[model samples]
Target: MGKFWGKFLRSTAVICLLIIFAVNYRFEMKKTIDRFKKQSDENYYAMEKDVSAVNELLNILETSGNMYYKKNSNIGNHNFDFRYRSKDDIYVSTDDSHRLIAGVNKISSNWAVKKELDMSEILSESYKNISKVMPDIAYMYYASKEGFVNIYPEISKDSYPFLRNIYRLDFVKKELFGKGNKKEEGVSWSDVYKDPLGDELLITAGAPIYDSNTLKGMITLSLKSNFFIKKIDNNLITDFFIVDQKGNVISQMSHGNEEVTSFYDRLPKKLYDKRYKFSDMKPCDIEKIGKYYVYYEQCNSAPWRVYYVTDMVKLNAELLRGNVVFISIWLISLVFLYGASRRKAVVEDSQQTIEKLQVMLRKSDREVEKDFLTGAYNRKGFTKIASSELDRMRRYDLDACVIMMDIDHFKKFNDTYGHACGDFVLKSFVRTVVKNVRLSDIVGRWGGEEFLVLLPETDYKGALLAAEKIRKMVEREVFYYHKQSLKITVTLGVATLNVRKTLEKSVEEADEAMYSGKETGRNRVVGYQDIMSKDIKWKK
Candidate 1:
């Protein structure tokens, strides 16, 4: 009888030990999987940030270029070789009386150079015609080292000479020889190249002067490419580079010394081969390149690929490590509880219940944070995250920007089309916004037709430029439904958190600027400073 009792007790003890070991093993495996999942999630978020920064940077570059172009179109013609002394000697002679012969001549000698002139002659003709037509004659000159010389009329030569020389003329070095002004050379021109004649030039608009396919020289109607580098160097944080189809490095914001191989050099070989299907947003780990969160969009129309790359591991490792620590603590606590629990049945049941509850809570949290339609952050989620960011900025004394956007005439579209169309429009809008916004920037559906974006470590000017880009992208996207095409436009209001007294103030300022955009024109971007200067009252 004593031996039977002892054998039964030993069998029970062995069974219990086996059960405990199995449960603990399963739990540890789950923890490992969960750890992987958590890492993946953190990586995903970091990738998002990287992508957003790229998009915003591209947008800023594009918008600034556009603005510069609009401001000074005839930038190349600002500086002309005008014989100031031989003003009286210059006679408007032509093949016919109706035509005029305008050529350069030496002031000291009577020897007149009949069309021994550069491309500026054509511009001078145009200016002459304009002066004949208009009462007031203001002219500017943009001298080129080679190719067509540019001429502008009705411009303040003193003020915009440098701009004209740098942007429009494509002059490598410009020397302004004036009485009072010291000879100014090597001055980096602004991206916003403004001609005295009110023409704007874009640095990106590289309109080359080709002499029958042989690259003699290039003509730019905007700032020099070097100017772009200097500006980017001054403002942008992330490393930026412009690459051509042959993988030749055209320009770089930083990290230019790195070899320029194929665009594939930046991406995995598999991704390079399958370029068409490659995701614009992906986190890739490179050995010496470091962990880069890369986003690239091929310019099918242009001979270029616009890409943004950042060191992902270095930027977000701290956050990821912190998250891992928290998860490790939770797992350790669970393991301790499992080891200490004596009642096997009760313990298993309790562990299962806790796990289920934790899953439920996480799911609930995700649902609240994510947009139902697009799986992006909702307004509330954006606010929460933005608040956290604001706190961080305040603590760190960092820069940040916010952009407010609204669909143009969305109400009219809803009225003209059905509610179904409206929903489609909303979905389309969200898609475009998501596609354009930087992964670092927070984009959310603020309300029905309104969206908000938070750009960390950016200034008001940059935010305004970013908003303009989003507006342009939304405008460009073709929305098709049932063989019907619908064009969409948006108005954006930009404000910088770096400038505002408080986060609330920034939001309010941005909101007001957005309303101003609505009032001024439906499709435009209004800066917060402009709104405040107007003293218009509004709320966020």
Candidate 2:
């Protein structure tokens, strides 16, 4: 009877110990999960904040560029004297040539000879008023039916002889134009030259002048690209570049190497042919190059792309460090709990609990870095992965590319079909994009309606093919909603990252190329280097 009682007592004690161990293990697991959830929430909020701030900066720069161009256009229309340069040698109408008598005895009644009247003087006088109002005016020129006339005092005859020929009102030929234009108009930006001044690159703002119900000539406002670049206050540490549709670097603001001109010119020919349909900003990391966040916005009614990029490593490292420290504290708390727990069964349970907690913590970390919707690395996740990939590529001298894609008219679809349908489209897009890419490729949801695909061991040619395949797949895939079939298309930009290039620059170049695609049309891929090779001409 005493033996039976001892056995019962021992069994009861063991059961109690097991129960206690289970309870403690459960509690610790719950605590760890809670801590992870809280940390993840905090990290997500911080990432959102960072994205908003950077987006705001980009918005400001975009707005400033628009405003500057608008204001300049308005000023040009209101202040400048519009005149047509004649192709034929004809005397200016005496009535039209009459001078205002402010201090003179009488108004000049003689017909102004093309050569007799000081063309430079008339232009200088007309531009003097403009200079007073717009101090940023480096130079202005008026092309009439007769010849080229320099309106600004700063311009010299020796520096711009071509201005005379360009002002001689002639019909635009199709052969000299880019792929898009069949016929060019009189008042267009197409006739503008970059290397005209012989010293620095210049962008011309041209407007055709009308007289007597006829196209007389055109007026051009030549300003250095530097003037526009100066307006953007360099806030982020990333380099800024303004690229034309052809991928030519119009202007760049950077602290790095300067001898990289014609960089985009080196892109494969196949990529250049289809570069005018892509448009989106994408974030990515390059191993030794660092982290990059990029966005592209097109100028209204222009073929230009304003590409903005920032170094993400420097920007987010501080914030990520703070989160890491917070995580460390939670880990230390878990260790303390483990040490305090006692009992062999309890210890075993606690070990299992710790293992589960560790797994949860690791998963939480992944979630924080990954995009919830697509399961691809989020912007943060891309940054981490890209850095590593870039390092691997560089160390082994491998080729790789980053492709960015955005759905065309995505907002309109969302507005018309509802958010649920929009989500379906996004998910469908991710599936299609992933399927079209190689297993070695990494695809991520870059942000709202945008995605980035990292192609390792691929050159520009390979990247372009992949981009084209994905573009076609997305275009062909149909999304169903309430028995209605809907099709969606996307624009893609591809840029290769090589040993000499930084990841930020590569992404920016790709973004610029993508926007060029958007400007031309949708459902196409654009290679950064390819577009830069040819001079892209825009029709009025």
Candidate 3:
């Protein structure tokens, strides 16, 4: 007997250990699924915000380009190109208009001032348009091939003299005369460069200006690097940055040093050695980099990528906490199970009783709520269910409609056939309607031959469509009683809920319309508005 008991104890301990392992595995799986869900949501919202910002900036650029185009069309024939003259006649050698305007340069200094004023007015308009959208624009200026810069609004007398040769700036040489700018007709962004005036890092957006087919000049909008950083820095809990195609850091949400130029340089040696380029990174791709997990997304409007980096230390800690708790629970359960093995029969009996009581309670609740024959909600249950649904719709400011329907001449059919046949028809009709409506919609027996359907988030137009579909479906359904084919049709009325009325009032409106449909045509759907209009038309 002692040997038999020892074998039994070994078997029970093994089974309990397996149960603990299964529980721990299931818990960990659930946690992993939840973590991924949260990560996906975070990535989606982050991408959406940055994409919207880029799109808005693109729109501002397009608007600025159109302004320049209009100015060119209005003033191209004026021949005022010689406003800025050089001893070398550099512009004149390239542009024929420069020669034409230079021939007439002896006119007057007043005419030259007028031409400058006209150009300044055009620049001012462009500045106003862009500044209104992006108030933090660093500078709005036009750079001409003649090495002239027209800074808008008001350029200080000290800076105006120095800015005249801005065409020599690296931004113009790299962005305007660069390889990508030659073929692309759209706006182009320059890599971050130090502002000569303030020594702050800034980026430029350049839109090319053309004279018929000749490249003339460009309208440039400059913005400080902090424009991108400030918008996102304070909101982020983890490290986030924007990087160029070459893995050069364009802007970071919160970097201690503005001097950190490349994203790859900041990475741990192990990660940098992997040679992961920014251009190759896909949207929402997460990669393990040393002790960190990095997520990146490609911008739709810019040739840049956004990255979010999370430290794996915190994640490991959370996993450790979960495992520790799971082990502690397993240890406690092991001891409890060993002690309870002697009274397993009594415990099993109690568990069975609890389950039986739960089953009875569920059946009792179901019986109270459900219709005996149709499997739909009864009047009391439907009122409770539909009112809750209506409350949710109102809370969310969503559109919803209630459809009231009745079988045409249902009482007459019941009298002709037996009660059992009538019951069969009701069940079949409800079943067909249930299958036709959306899963979100609710069907309930509103007593006798009438039924009510609550369609959440459906507008008046959608509800009308739904009611028409049900009307046609009911007309087509062929019910069979005994060996003979039976026919039945339903009239429906739809009323959409609005701020002006309550849910009950909407249902009353549908009920009235349903009666109206029966009075006019036995197999049709009528909206509450239709009945109201017909009544008014009859009175007239």
lDDT of 3 by residue, 1-540 (tens): 997898798678869798878887677644533453245335435544544464565556545544555554442233334433344332211232211112112223354333433443354455666677676677776665544455544443244334534555666886456644344456667666666545566667776655334454566777777666554422112567777655667677557435538887766576678655544554546666666666665453455667766655555554444455455556666657556653222123445544643443342222135664587876656778877876776687777789999998887667888776888889989999998999988898886789999888888889999999998998998988776688889999999876557878998999999998999977999999888888899999
Error of 2 at 169 (Å): 12
lDDT preference between candidates 1 and 3, better one: 3
Worst 10 residues of 1 by lDDT: 107-116
lDDT of residue 539 for candidate 2: 25
Q: Give me the candidate number with maximum lDDT.
A: 3
**Considering lDDT, where higher is better, how would the candidates rank from best to worst?**
3, 2, 1
- TM-scores, in order shown? 0.32, 0.35, 0.45
Query: Which candidate, 2 or 3, has the higher lDDT?
Result: 3
- In model 3, which regions exceed 4 Å deviation? 1-120, 126-129, 152-169, 178-184, 230-237, 276-281, 317-540
Backbone clash total, candidate 1: 29
Evaluation by TM-score, superior candidate among 1 and 2: 2
Estimate, for each residue in 184-210, the C-alpha lDDT of model 2 and write its tens digit.
Answer: 332233322344434555555554433
lDDT digits (tens) for residues 1-540 of candidate 1: 997887787667657666765675566444433433333333333333332333343344333333433454332432223433242333222222222223222212211121212233433344445345422223323333232233343223243223323333323333221112322211122222223334432222222222222222222223222322443321112544445534544445554332334445555454455555432332222112324434443331233444544453433443333234334444454445445553322223445545653553362222135654455576657878988897888788898988888888887777887766887888888888888878898887765677888999888788878888898888888999667899999988888786346767877888898898899878999997876765665542
RMSD of each: 20.5, 21.9, 21.3
Tell me the RMSD of model 1 versus the true structure: 20.5
**How does model 1 fare in lDDT?**
0.50
Candidate order by TM-score, decreasing, is 3, 2, 1
